[model samples]
Target: MNALLIGAVLISFSSVMVVLAGLPPEVTGFYRLTGGGMAMLLVLARAGKLKLFTPNTIKWGCVAAVFFAGDFVFWHRSIAFVGPGLSTMLGNFQVIPLAVVSALFFKERMPARMYAAILLALGGLYLMVGVSWSGFSADYRLGVSYGLVTACFYALYMLSLKYALSKDRVDALVLASAAALVSGLILGGLALAEGQSFVIPTLKSLAAISALAFICHAVGWFLVTRGIQTVRGALVGLLLLLQPTLSFLWDILFFGKPVNPVELSGVGLALIGIYIGSYTKRKKRTQ
Candidate 1:
């Protein structure tokens, strides 16, 4: 639980890191993945686990990577427009789609409470984005859209990575390394297409991005994955709420963003809805 809490906090810093790095989204994504991949590779090689990369692992990792890259692109873009706190909160909507996918494909049963929870979450989201009959600004709407798209991509990444890890044949480090490498290559191409420079302009920017990669992606996610193994899925979902809550705090503390009371209320409601939606009923034992 402690590790999971630490991982959640570390993951929350990613959006702040991107904002602080002050680089184009594509470039930021590329550098982050490349650095994290290299670090993971080194760690895996040192542990003699490089030989555990099977073909299935590579294929699934690449698939996960593509989704991850898409998530990063949209998330960073949304951050620029909507601010980190709202964007992070919006991105966490992946849980809704994840639930839908599971129910559709895996025959997972969702109780009535889950449906109510979903509605509450959607309402909360509407409030968070300041959407109403009066209408929202175009930029705010676009940012909201991007953040939702990010959730979709992140859902796909999580599902694919979960499947890959379930195989148990490949080391977690190898899979992470492969995913990062593939994400880096894809984002590099995107950067070129967008006419963004690949070069790091300043040492500060480089250090910021490097820390994002090493600390957020490599170490944070590693801790998360490890902690997930020992925690219940429902509990994990609840713990993940910390990421966005802390992200909101960082946005205010570090970026001097103003607090919106309505939005903060929405965040609280959405988090409650997520907790309710993620609730898993345990079966009763018969004596």
Candidate 2:
């Protein structure tokens, strides 16, 4: 039930992020993340759950900041090269890398049935993005590259979080605050260096971005961290599928983007794979 709730929240957050992709990715990432983190900080302070930063918390937070920085940098560039839809789908392919990273570094294991499910999920991923192959050679190649970088860096971030959680029982808000500070300073500098002007957002965009900050960056990321504390990295990778699937839905409903047979088939397979993966694992635990 917790997993399902986390999945639902992640899907909603993914929809929000895709919409915000129109903004300069770096500046938008900074504001959305920093604002959201700040809001949580306030909540933590009010509740007196916020913890003081020891060397350990700060150390883990900074490591996570590196991967976070990489994800924003690369994934945003992916959106610029590929259209938002394909960019999103491809960027999400990082689940493969994440699972590998977990298995290798963290020795994270899963039931054999769940491992089979992972392969099916990857095959589904291929189908999901393969539809855009028509007249999409150059852009597709670049998008795949950017997306792969995003995935690899994300794995690093996931592993770092796992390490941090293993070390201490810090508040989610505290870790978020630390990450926001480090990520913001690094990415903010890059944005300035690139001359990506931080223009004032229009009313609509501001409202949208604010929702993004609170719902996606803050709440969504927090849930992700929470899930990582209990679930293995491979499982977290499967769950990240929520991002693209939800983004696809948003495109359909809000943007009026139509889907065809190929896309639907791909989505169907991916959903089935996720179901299979989760079920296989759950069945084992119950046994």
Candidate 3:
């Protein structure tokens, strides 16, 4: 499979896998990262490339992990206040922050067409979530606030990971392992402080959590990190629309959610935007 396709499939599974794990958010996050980290460590050791703890690697890896852990915590909490669909849609606002950061810090030039593509993708995402603007409760407002915070941390994580990958000394395996290790440690500590049990409640839950760790966290994110090395940060954000879009389809198919025509149309628009964004070429600077 192509890198984009791999990334799309992996990310699409992430939310669903979290739900299937059926644990408290912090505990789920901890296991997912720990399991993934251990798996990556085994892979690195087998390949005789485990010597990946250089100063630059440690610095950027920990930075990315911290942001990722924050993103996970806020987003999972938002899901309790708001429904997952709306929370996910709001969390995806990371694209805006990512675009701004890229322009200011990375100095990566964006084309006009790219901006149009981003707008189209976001519009489609808004529609896909079927957002209701009419009602606002305190809880819902709090959830929205949390979701927005999740977006900021998520954007930072992506940017940090991109920067880490750009260094010659860092590879995808090491970065993924380091991120998972640090995130797991931080989240595990939070889970304990919250008095959440670390033990899996059932064999079924254990299986699900293991799948999340190995498949979604280890394999899925590994491919995504590798893919982002070739793809731009802004474009990667646009491409991740596939995750929520697919998650919507899963809900409709398995969870007995009523299908809406408007939302279906939103899926079409999101796909079109992804295509446009993927193909849009940056104009070359004339020296």
Candidate 4:
């Protein structure tokens, strides 16, 4: 639980780091992945856990990498389009798709409370982004679209990761490190193809990127993966919500993104809805 709390808070700084770095989307993703991957690799080597990568681990790690790649590309683009808060919130919308998948494939029961929660989340989104979506500039709309796309890929990544963790017996560090390295390679190629430089020109940008890699990616993900293994699914969702919620607040505090009453209300509704949707009553033990 402490791991989840700390990890969520740490990762919530991701958008702020990206904003501070002020680099191209792919560039930021590249450095984040590669640098964090290397850091994790070193940690694994030091701990002598580098031998834990099995065939199953590699396969699932590759799968996670692909989905993460898509997520990073679209999510960073969305961040460029909209501010961090809204973009992060939009990405966290993965819960909607994930729930639908659960119902369809896993045969999970969706009660009325869950349904209401979904509607609330959607209503909140409508207030935040949908209401003015058409009236907004082309870039903004495009950002919103990318954000939704991000949610899809993020759902896929979560599914793959959860499966990998449950079935593969792979250490979380091994999976995370390998996936980050692979995704970094993919993004690195894309960055080069798009003519983006790998150079960090300013020390400030370097510091931000370093913090992003070591703090947010390496430490944050390690703690999160550990916590997710122990925490219940619904509770995990509620705890992880801290990431976007704090991220939105950070955007307001740091980025000076303008927020109106309608938008604030929307955020509240969406957050409440998400919590309600994810809440599950514990069943009493049978004698």
TM-score of 2: 0.79
Misplaced by over 4 Å in model 1 are: 131-135, 167-170, 232-234, 279-287
Per-residue CA lDDT of model 2 for 1-287, tens digit only, reads 36534744554554445465457878877776677778767766787766566677777788889888888788777766654555566555555566667677778775676577678767776676655766567865777678768867876776677678766876555776787778877788888988887774577777777777777776776666566557654565456666676766766776666677876787667666655554422223443
Instruction: Count clashes in each candidate, considering only residues at least 3 apart in sequence or on different chains.
Output: 0, 0, 0, 0
Assess each prediction's global lDDT (C-alpha) against the native: 0.85, 0.67, 0.76, 0.88
Off by over 4 Å in 3: 2-7, 81-86, 125-131, 136-141, 223-241, 264-287
Candidate 3: Cα lDDT at 236? 70
Q: RMSD in Å for candidate 1, one decimal?
A: 3.0
lDDT of 4 by residue, 220-277 (tens): 9889988977778778878988999999999999989999999999998999887886
Model 1 vs. true fold: TM: 0.90
Which regions of candidate 4 are displaced past 4 Å? 105-111, 228-235, 278-287
The regions of model 2 sitting more than 4 angstroms off are 1-21, 81-86, 109-111, 131-134, 222-243, 274-287
Worst 10 residues of 3 by lDDT: 276-285
Q: How close is candidate 4 to the true structure, as a TM-score?
A: 0.90
With a 3 Å backbone cut-off (N, CA, C), the pairs that clash in candidate 2 are: none
lDDT of 3 by residue, 195-283 (tens): 99888888888988898889877777667767766776557756666776676566556555564777677667756655555453444
